[model samples]
Target: MTFNIAFSEVTVTIGNVSVDGYTEDIVVPITVSNPNESVGGFQFDVITMPTIINISDVSSVNENDFSADFNIFDDGTARVVFYSNTGEGIPAGSDEVVLNLHYNGMDVLSALVDLEGFNLTVSDADGDVIAGNIVDGSVTIGNVVFFSSDIPDTGDVLEQVSVDISIQNSGLVGGVQFDMYDTPNYLDVINLTTTTRTEGFQIDFNELDNGATRVLLYSPDNQNIASGSGPIANMEMVVHDNAYNSNVGVNFENITITDDIGGSYWVAGVDSGTVTVTPGYIEEPHNLQAQDGMDAQVLLSWDPPYGPIPSDFSEDFEEGVLPEDWITTTNSAQGWFITQDGSSAFWTVPSHTWYMCSNDDMADDDGSVDYLITPGLNVSGAQNITLNFASYYDGAYGQTAHVLVSTDGVNFTEVVTLEPSPEWVMETVDLSEFAGLPNLHVVFHSNDNGAWASGWAVDDVFITFAAREIDRLVHYELTELGQWALTAPKDEVMSRFGGGLPHNLKVDLSQPFLTENRPVELDAFKVYRSLNSSTGFQEIAEVGANTTSYLDEDVVNSTTYYYYVTAIYPDGSESGPTGTVSATPVEW
Candidate 1:
């Protein structure tokens, strides 16, 4: 019996694997080194924990003259027996594959495969015992749960910032622990709180190495609880007073969770978050200084304007008297003047008055040209300049208003021509191409070419520098994909289409607001509608941030509806409403 074998090796090809929900299959191979003798048969008992893996199939690799038969017993063990089928036995002094085993994952855990040396036997062609050493292999099949969430991007200095942790999946678990680390230059974690707790699980944490590193842990003392997906913890930090960067890095490192059973598992992935430190709001008083004459050589000085102005600026003409900052041409007779409560001889609505009007006294100056220019605006540091204004014009078609712009009041360029409308209409003009000019001017020059029916009445003028481009999100009833690429919202003001329900209309919605910036994500959009343009604007719907549109099936036929959108932020703040659009429902 000179059967001296080199080694017996059992190897599982892959390392740790994550099981999604159900069981998965794995293949294991066993090989052996032979001695200077022919081999005839071999027998081994495969053992594994019943809660980890179950032997499903066992078979020989089918050598030239060998066959195998295996029987899985109730005791979580398998007996595999191999013998020479044909007369010729396997040659010696070579490494050969002895068997291929198939295993089924049982629970969410790691399983080991071992060959019991006491019950294992090897024989030659003469049915005599042979010698060999045994080796084992293992496979880990389980889920490594973790949290994936976002935090607000922009935060004021000293503002409270909090981040949450959540589990990705469900399993019987003991506890979870992780170390949070980051450069303390932006913010300091002042407190750690548990949002969720397992039954009988105790929570503990300690500062590590430096104050910037924190270790958090939670586990049950005597028993385990079924753990599932939800918030597990929250870390609150205060923004540093001196933090003045565009972005700060915050990360959760070395996150791990333990099973209620035997071993612990690490998170499969992690999504890091960032915090942006923005300057605090500095209020500067609004001073109505006397406007300089429209002489280009005057070089009007913008005396100590208020602190950092918003990207978008607006004036609704609510102030009965025109601001002195607005410059007027020498010919004041034909220039613009603010009128309130039917004060002007021209048109005025009780519900919506307070507008600047070109003198409707046609007898005073027929065919007269009047120019009303805005205060010198600082657009040198902005992008996407836009001008929006509401106007009422019922004069002859040729008797119109021309919107003009100038960097120097001396040289002006025409941007748009407005036609006469019996009712008030809101209009937007793109001034993006002319941005970055320091001394920018928006001028409304009116030409009374024909019969002055009601002259030009303007209100709600918004001259926005670096006009924040509306980031659009649209929702549809039937879309091919759930989420689509980002796009700028459609800028259609007061558009009427045919579609609405008998009671409420299922209106498709699209908005131009962003929801990505953390901490201040766009939460929702408040929808407003009016029966007529001049009156009755009421909130009709509230849609989520991720949703693009809403179906307003609450309406009646033959009734016209005007719609507007206001973006709501996380801090209960709201952006100005979008220009109103109209929709009317009709019976088929």
Candidate 2:
């Protein structure tokens, strides 16, 4: 279609920044360019915000919706210019859009109607300002780089010093190096064995002085992992994008020495005791072994791995006292159980097939499998879906639990959504639809988004067909549209949505089905004491959701009273039937 069109309008809008708040007046710029044919009047909407990098550019714009894709003309043209963000922070984020065809038709033209809201959140976490509670935001310090992850203290592998870091840049490079300082002094290897670790993880950080080195995994040998050794200990690297600042300064903490395993270590000069903190403990190499005796040729009784536990993480430990949470599954010399080696491991049998991916293999593919799972997961699930798998899902990278299920031993459909991570909540899906599934073979999977390098885990497959609420009926009638939403005084419904192991309840089977003694599984239960439904309630019982099933222990002899129940989910989430389980207690 040969035609011409142009856009001419100036308008931008931003909703009030409340939650977490925004501090910019990002605007959308409209430009109508008519080629091929002549068409007047520009009209369009700011449908969605694209990757925004500069907030200042947006703040000065006339349009409210900043980083978004907007087309001014219908007459298609191969040549076009548009605005986009690049570094640290810019256009925040939002599933919603902002700034519709707020411009007049005379200046802008658009076929796309209806726009949504836009949200933005950005900044540096370590610098002056840090981006926290990040959802979909990203850091884009273009052509600029700094130390990424902190330098790891090799503790006792006392060899060289350097850490790997995830760097983001487009610039001139400089020499990367390190140095030791103070009492816990170490040597700076002059002739370094600078080798890159994994495929994507190249931690050849050149240690210049004692300042921060652009390394991800730290080591004492002043080099990356050597050929075919265990996995390389690395971290994200901070590179100098510009020659002006090629050498970033390191600090005392950056002075790490790769300690040799089987040696004593010091913490704040205090004796950490004769502990062996090796990079790994593989089984194939008589010198290395996994905690669970995974690849061990001999029986290795499992012991408690130091540091971290669900309780230890969520506990109140005093000075000098250790926490009690790590549980041992097996103490026998014959049974399969994970052991507490230098690092966490996965293996039950002595199959001699146990290895963890190190910073190398753990990366995309450069095969250095010295990996480990810290406080590794151990949960259960059922069907085409997984139940409760534990994982520190890299919040930065959208990750899904990779799961494998098979009706027969040969075929497998990768289940995309595994159990939710780092939470006690349960995510359940129906597998009754599987061709042969809800049937036989099933295995949990973890889809590593390739960011954290930390693998996903599964402990158990709880194939316990969800014992649903017995005889519970969730009819459309039972499901209220906005029952949970704040409603008019009498608009709320009473539901058993929060049905849990209730400690107390009073079920008066007498005048059932009334305002009183209405055992609702919502906010609360309003129990009434009346001889009949004809009279109003006497507010005899006031039980909260925590009060699941109540016991009508106190009742007048030969008296008839009704009861109600209500439940409240922890989120102050309310549900109901308005007349949950109403019963009249008769001396039956």
Candidate 3:
């Protein structure tokens, strides 16, 4: 003989909860559901991560009909038992709260609240067991501590560097402590100071033997850093002399954050900063020369040390087709196309033999959007970048053209919005803000907002980096013999006209140049002279930084002298001697 019994299907679920920070009491309902109205008693255990949350108390939903008893454990568990005190079973219902579990957030984290499978029980009025299903819940707490990203600064060897330390806190912060480490042998931490966000906080730090800096910040008056995001502290360090041409990193470890009540919070993330150290020595000077002057002088001039300004990237679209690396996207029938012939009367084509054009007149007018993007360019080493292109656009019927930039392929930012023009015009856009980006991309965007209009044409696109300015003497002329004779006596002029009269040399310098790279300050120009072309050069005179010419009035007529010039820095550093030039002083 065999007997079969069917149990009612009852589901007991724990509800999810989320809070911004630590809370004294958070209520979570334990709901029950069944098709049969025979639930008389229930028992279960709620378990959570001990480090994230703790169960505080439990209560019965129907106090008059049922009585509840709960036991809290130190390991973040609560055992609850509910019984029908009036001998009346709970009515059949969907998602009815049978028990309320209270919890206290322990840290900034997320944890699962699970029902103990082996300890769960659901019984009917007569104490018969019923089939049960369990559903778990979760709790999340929010507070984040991190360093600012891309904190980049350029410096020479043995220079001091500073970087910001930022945070995002959901709750007030009363204190913080962390250990900062730098790239071994590259940087040494000095100290830290409070920023505007932590103006009145007390700060202290100690340099450890292992090249790590341990820092602590707190408030003596129980003041709290308001919950928000910004820099809280600034760290100062010095780059080692051997760190030249290197990108040194500063990182954080062993971080701890505390609230006003002395409870510790979890650190969400951390980021490092990079210090780029440039070479310390100056480059060699260029374009040195000595020019002959009337009768008895040799004029010397030279250009400063400089790097050439060249286009880092350029495209003329003369290949008659789009390059394989470039990309195009469109939402309508027409998009960017390479063509030599201008077919639309409404569009003013560029004068290039081949160019890219987004013709709105040919595109479907249903809100056409088109984009032409360049390949990813590594411009991290470039300073003072710029974008230049030849463009033609005659707008009509709500059409628009824009030049955008992006570090990532997505999420472009408009750098230039083109105005309507009747003919081709050259456009230059300052891209200095994006100079240190590695994977930068340029976008040419066009849109016809649901109406037909003239389109945009572009050619000769270029991305360039500004070079260091090098001032040079471009022109030099010797004063005519008649000018020198104006002040000379007839007998003296007659004797010195062939070889012995004084010389006057006039030299002109090129216009003052500008650059965004590391530019050295000019203290003065040092002029040097040599009787031989290759050796025995001696410093003859020193002139101001703005000086362009030097007259060697001690020269003897008919004697050839070699000369070169160098730029001097305030730190007593002098550039390499410029190219030597030889000239002989002679009567005109």
Candidate 4:
């Protein structure tokens, strides 16, 4: 049997309200008709922003045949249910008052009070799904307000990006609802913070469909905002490295404001913004900081907190092809060529890619010097520069490899000289004395002076700043299962389960370093655990790279343990241990 349930009118007139000491009554009448059988029960939710209105009571008009109750949830939706009390039910074609909703004006706001009729139902004295058309109602509350913007038009990749949301001439507001949007694949929202008058209230943010995010802010005590301007919220986002040379769009949708006097305000228009991510050699300039110093101290450092360092620049040439920008020159026919060498067989230490130069590839040495120079590195404004690489040489005819640095790439300065070695030797050169230069060119010169030169092989070339402290936090908690879990992102409390427990420290290596769309690659991760806070830490386990988290299960009840993780690179370079985190296992 087909049954139709709908509101009596399109919009129940809620005329007007004063700003202070206001009280008003709003009645919403629900009707039912076209019933193929007797109607026994019905249910629906009155959805509206609580900051705008207060639902004091919801009683049925036909109390002789049915009784009703109203319940409100924290999300501001009121659920109303009415069921038949008498033995007989309302017959078909009977259209009378089924519900009388009572609302009090709490705020002067503007929005649609909706009757979500999806759960609306009618039964023939027996509980059954009734098939019919459920026409919902949309009731407008107040007047139209506006949402404005003052965001920048463009930004650079890896640059700090932020946007602001402002309310235009809004007064005595208690709550707001809006949708925020950004370039789907190019921009990532990292963090959001409240601003101005809204900072005094609580906010809820959730991700929506099609790369949109929703934000709702309301007074904790249901108080009204008297006056405010500027930004209401600040959103921090990042432009992906792959977005170089492209622009990302930012906009808002479905915005509304609610005053404390039971009135709602619709946003007149949404002001949009855009950010253009440009290509650059460096993500951003180093955040240099000054330190207190004594006489002739030169107390400049690249540590974090006060000073932060930039990501390293590295190249392995694993593709078996030299980068087009890399420089290669030779006074003779035989130059540096990437080839398989018996002396440089191992892949882990230096990398999978290696380059070699020797007289064996030429008919005669001719006392020629071959050069393999790297492309210009943008280490401008950087301090304490360093270079690391692996080389293998046989020392035939006293042939040596010379490492040189250049500012103009044409005029070279000899930095270090390497003797012949039968096995691969890792080298570290301190380029700190030459810091503060804009363009840095590193060159490897191999000399074969008309003599039998065995070979010169180099691999895993990397240029990085000095190691800095790792960021981390630790926590201890008692769980329901009575076991302690060591979480990377520190938390106050934790929960545990039976034997197969989860204790993975989730890591998000989502940001790119140099390669397009490719994240920084690590060979492995070493987790260190310590029982005594003042003593040494021992390696507990080692996991492979790209593994986001780790599970550490070994612990004794009532004992406290600390943990930290270090990333291992293919060139045998290890990152500084992350900040230590602690957890105590206790049975409750």
Candidate 5:
């Protein structure tokens, strides 16, 4: 006997999914609805764009009711077959997922998942074809938000640094907002600005009471940013002076992006970065020792270490005229000239009272080009060459400035472009590429491109470099106790200490021995003392870098105190502590 059953039409659908471009092994489900009879078997081919995504596998959602198998083709097709092994059927239900299609993303794009490529078939328990409606779906790849810093590992304290917040493989975006957080003791946010990619957008930021900086960027005209990879905003910050020998992290939270029509975008992932603060290029004192003296005094001695040397070509523009050998070439009447006046209404004052000025506001013509050239420099044996200067520019009418270098003073190569700064700011340009050139010349060029713009002013120009060793040294005569210990005559030392009677303690000192001949200019020396050998050290006194010894009268008799010394650079960076030495003082 056979029982006849009436089966309603079934609707089959491929579910849509959104994932990140870096995602792998994504699962999309195929669902069934409005089926009156039990479903026995089904077969279909899932197809997609070959370059956007590829099918990996297909699995049955209801494993006990059905078994599934799939074959992936090279043309971005997956043939899926599902059937019941025990001759039983899956009881039809409302919106039931039968099979899942797994895929891997090949690129950042959108692709249609179509089911019309192959013959889609469905059968009932009586081996009869079931009429059904098939629906297609889609897959969308999303964007990745991350952070990057120019200072990858380490930066000096009080140095200005920048961190970039970027989006990768992005879609068309209309607006973005996020909150950034960092240790307040480590870094201080100065300002937020737009990059070249988002220069047309308006940007603003607010510092919350909870130490979070909230930033927002959007176009007033509802314009969208096309798909690309770049920094949307740049964060300018200054490292705190107390952040030395520490790692500081910058993080993002509550990130959101919107399309032109106010739809939310899917974010794939987010990443953060950190910077370490370190004492740069300074050396610590060496061979520190202490000895007991009569009348309960502790005598300390150490060798001073080297520090960063001063530049040879430093000009403050205080002579009221251009130095000899300096040249100026201009197409305008008002070219480069020295001035101490700051009464101009168009341009700001220079860093110092006297500075070089290229006044476009005082020019007669519309377009002006001016060049200030330096004298021939001899940097044949220098390393880490750099050019630093203080500048004030008013770019109200689109004036431009640049720093260039040349070997013949005729053919110049651009080293860096200067940005508009209404106030006085320091600019640094790396010149290591032209380090070995014997006759290198530097040029400061300014242009007002057919516009009545303000002017540019510069002061305190310096061209610094490092060499193998110091060429000259300043001699010190016997003045202080520290100098007398290192430079006193033999007879003078005997007259002070040779007698057996009670006398002041004498600590002999020597100059620092250099393993490698890299000589830096010294600033000062710091002395630290502790009761223990390894910890609890406090700064006792500071002396000149040339001074080699110190007399500590603030000590207890017959008590041992450990001491160490460190060198301080001109930039306020301190070296690591030297080896510890012990001393005991007593009354004779």
Candidate 6:
């Protein structure tokens, strides 16, 4: 007798799967059908179900009639029975009984396991793999068909060596997928997400963020597969998490990575490392200052605010201090003077020099006080021999306060005519008129009272010479997997992260100076200056950090000043007097 059952509609269907020797419910709504005669004892036989339940298991009967729940991660089994409602014996072509089964759930994924193994051989620049070179190495995605051209002798990812491994999913599981993970350093996905397009490799992952039991396949390249065996056909992926490798990393270890200098590695599955470079400690700006007592009792000193100034410095300059050559002048008469032209405040005394320029060289005439300095000057080239000072005018000496500047100094060029102030006033003169002259000289001449002009007070003299120098770049390599940054550059670079100056005491240099792949603390630095350099070099400034800059205003125009930043260790030892800052300081 043949049996066939059709249901008008499923009254109730329960589905289930087995795990750890027990049956668990996974799904529902199973229908039953019997077409053979009056045989009537049909029920679910959990013990009699076949061990393996795959898509092929539903071939003999309609899934609606004997459907059972299953875990995408678990291995399960199922069984089906037939019966007749009438007591009449077996009959052929019997077909009026409804067949249905009920199921609750499934667990296919928890029932599977995957494993991968990689065999590598390392080598030097030469393409020879050393023997027995196994250290720490691993592959991310598993289920490979292990293949290798040559076996590694040293276990290193030896040059031009081949490696292979077997890949397989233990069984059917929900959201479970497979692929090959290449060499540690060259470990790339081989399957395309959209298609099996093998341009780049594909990496599959479980989407923990999404509630759906979907397997995610990815490839670095945007290639489409013709067979369309991967992701949903043309399912627009909004975000592909290229950083998933970061989440469930696969990295390279001691194996020599291709295309990098010796010892370079992919390092524990990382795609790229964070390399930070920074200026050495000796490159910071140091204040350059100096003092000279020329022509007696005229205490003249000059200096600019320190270069690469410490972050602790405030913009408002609360310290009320200046760098080297920031000299304060005094007249034997204690004559008072203002900072910015006393009150006009509109004009700033840029540069100046003291001298005598008179209308007459008489014997019985009172001398006038005059000074010269450049005021409205703008330039963008190299220059030397600029002057800064204040002088008095003497009628007997034909204007003793007269000032002059020339490329040769001996060949003087008159700049501005000074209207001698009865008391004492300030003035400026710019030697920038000489354009690109590498040499400029400033001379102080006075015939006031026939070289006897008294009561003239000179104070607050300043000079600036620039010599710009270039610095090199240094890169830091990250040894381990994680995040890194310079603790100093953060607070030392005068950035928002350090709250501008006050917080920039440290330069976040990513160099592992003290400790390899780490950073070290450098002591203070000294700055050197050569005003004309004809006088060798003089000490200009000193700082307490690895400041790589220095600007000394005590330099003379046309004079080449060579400055060098030396790295001083905490033990008071110095490392570099190495290079100089070759800038001819110019205030434009």
By lDDT, the best candidate is 3
RMSD values for the candidates in order, in angstroms, are 18.1, 31.9, 27.5, 22.6, 24.6, 25.3
Give the number of the best model, judged by TM-score. Answer: 1
- True-vs-predicted CA distance for residue 91, candidate 3, Å: 4.5
Candidate 2, residue 546: how far the Cα is off, in Å: 5.6
**Model 4 agreement with the true structure over 127-146: per-residue lDDT tens digits:** 55454445565444554456
- TM-score for model 3? 0.33
Residue 154 of model 6, lDDT score: 15
lDDT of 1: 0.55
Can you write out model 2's per-residue Cα lDDT over 185-210, one digit (the tens) per residue?
Answer: 22232322333443332334445464
Sorted on TM-score, best first, the list reads 1, 4, 5, 3, 6, 2
- The TM-score obtained by model 2 is 0.18
Name the runs in model 4 displaced over 4 angstroms: 1-24, 45-54, 62-66, 73-77, 84-88, 94-97, 112-118, 125-136, 145-248, 253-380, 383-441, 445-588
lDDT of each: 0.55, 0.26, 0.69, 0.56, 0.67, 0.28
Which RMSD does model 5 reach against the true structure? 24.6
Tell me the lDDT of model 4 at 569: 54
TM-score of each: 0.40, 0.18, 0.33, 0.37, 0.34, 0.20
In the range 237-291, model 5's lDDT, one tens digit per residue, is: 8886545354678877887877666766655456775766666345675445454
lDDT of 6 at 359: 23
lDDT score, candidate 2: 0.26
lDDT of 6 by residue, 293-387 (tens): 11111111112112221221112111233322222222212222222111111111211222222222112243332222222222235453233
CA RMSD (A), model 3: 27.5
